[model samples]
Target: QFCVNYKNGGISYRSARDGFGFELDWTEFYTTTRKPSAGEVGALPVSGGVINGNLGIGTPNILGGSSIVLGDNDTGLKQNGDGLLDIYANGVQVFRFQNDTLESKKSINVTGRLTPTDYGNFDSRYVQDIRLGSLQYGQVWNGPGFSDTSGYVITGIINGNSDELIDGAHRRPIQKLIGNQWYNVVSI
Candidate 1:
């Protein structure tokens, strides 16, 4: 069982298992409004598995600075400010999405490819020995306790020469993923 009481008003509570329950006394229901002053104490009870103190003011998205920053700094995710979702595959950026409204039901889908031509070091290689392919998205490909998605593979090899390098050519599916709707999954 759980209960909440307002000094000037009444009390309310709810039990576990059945559903939700609440009650208010006349004084508590339509009680006189008594706003809290600067140092006044206001108490509200929240119940779940454990009970904790009330959430104080300035208790929103708060964070410090970072050592590195990826994507556009003007619109990158902020720690103390806002946050954006960034996705990467094999040390490469894939997509990024921002959560501006703080909505409960929100999701972003990213689709892109990594190619050898994209990297700077591969240009010197006399012989291109790298190949880039689509990474299959299996049901369990992402997150824990999931299976692998086939069709995704990275290919390339370095020649014997000290300067020889491997290049994996990749092609971004521009037609399929060209729009503001497609999130920028770049990360630091």
Candidate 2:
């Protein structure tokens, strides 16, 4: 049986079978004596409400398999059967979130600093080399056509090209420094 009761200045409706009912206190509604304007009759406020459960805008929650879906039917965020959160755009999977990992179909651009806590490896097949804008101090580079085995190093300064030295121990001619001059040491 359906019953309507007016008690304590409130109106309520109850179902006798399940004892489920709703009560509308008069003070909450009747306290505002002024009636709404023609435009405000069916209009809801833009803010000030708490939704405890899932909310769907243009599409239903069940149809999209997402807890919340925006106006577009193809775009939404859902947890897949694998327990991973997936983002969809235009009915295509764009991103997937796994354990500490985020996989994306498109490239990601970061405006701020992206610091990695751990070391990672890049595939040489996909990434040929890394280009940097500038290098810091104390860094060295090998010029083009430089070979490790055939490369030679200048030990000290030499006065001039005519000034050559003889190794006292080996009794052989070698490039040596006289005072503070520089010289080019060519590999033999």
Candidate 3:
């Protein structure tokens, strides 16, 4: 068991693998064989914030199941071909990272408190539409858009009518409303 000194003087229960990028207070960590049952394994806030439990940063599998594990071919967090971050809490995703960046530029190096509604969730087809929700949780991108123009690039609302345009553009909705809440998600 690895320990993290979370912001707000809060300590975290996770693994040493989660401590890769950030510094950790080794003394506060609770030594145990039990892996993190939820959230990123080592993505604690800087020094004084609460650890918002998310499945994206450290741990991959859902909690509660004894056999939860990182999927096959997975090397690190968000390394899956799905190409999106999965933020799960206690086995359920409370949020996700949907990148609208083009395949040529995959990482989101944006500044400030960026919200999912800011980007179109990696689908260039909807990039031009400012009126649409930028990103929704739970969705994933297979890869960059296909090389062929005949193959369409998708964004929010994978299988639905365009909200603003009168002409129906037939494409998959990259975003979907889960439990009536809009989240920038990449469906795997």
Candidate 4:
């Protein structure tokens, strides 16, 4: 049986087979898969703006805590275009993933920290690039497992006195640091 119920300010289908009809919204139309639960996907946001750019997709039902994450299990993070794919927080690009093999980019770029007065720009000094199969890193560039980070260009503050700088070959070492007492990072 076909049915139409004028409720919830706007009109919606109800009862017997609200006849599995189509819904018109804005410039698009959607067909119902089944009767929606009272609070299926939660209420729509009270307010928001239209998006006109790229975005990242994360694992379903997962909200980032201290750190935001993108991509998902059994998935491929792909962007097909002639532009850089970037992840930004607060209008600043914290990470950039790219497939450009040109001499300009060299490899992917990751921005961990920015200089105090250098917000909203890629300082390069504080950024880290993944650099897959880079020619400069030589054998370690996408080696059997992983190779030295020295080959790929990166910048970091190395404690000249306390902390040891293992491969100082490729890093643009900034020796301006306080007395040692530090944390460690594990990379693959």
Tell me the tens digit of each residue's lDDT in model 1 across 1-188.
Answer: 33446564544443333334444333222224644443333343334332242222233212223212334222223233347554333333345555643332334445876344444354434333323334322221123322222333323232334454422222222111222233222223
Q: Indicate the TM-score of model 1.
A: 0.14
Question: Model 2: residues >4 Å from true position, as ranges?
Answer: 1-7, 10-55, 61-63, 110-119, 122-149, 156-164, 168-188
lDDT of 2 by residue, 1-188 (tens): 23334454433343333335544433322224345543455544455544555667887664354356777666778777676898877777888899878899777899999987643343322433322222112112221322332224323332333435422111112332323332323456
lDDT of each: 0.34, 0.49, 0.39, 0.36
Cα RMSD (Å) between model 3 and the true structure?
Answer: 28.9
Per lDDT, what order, best first? Answer: 2, 3, 4, 1
Model 3 worst lDDT window (10 residues): 72-81
Instruction: State in Å the error of residue 70, model 3.
Output: 13
**1 or 2, greater by TM-score:** 2
Q: Worst ten-residue run, lDDT, model 1?
A: 171-180
RMSD of 1: 26.0
Q: What number of clashing residue pairs does each candidate have, in the order they appear?
A: 16, 0, 36, 0
lDDT of 2 at 9: 44
Residue 61 of model 2: what lDDT?
60
Q: Go through the candidates in order and give the C-alpha RMSD of each one to the true structure.
A: 26.0, 13.9, 28.9, 24.6
Candidate 3, position 81, lDDT: 33
Task: Kindly indicate the candidate among 1 and 4 with the higher lDDT.
Answer: 4
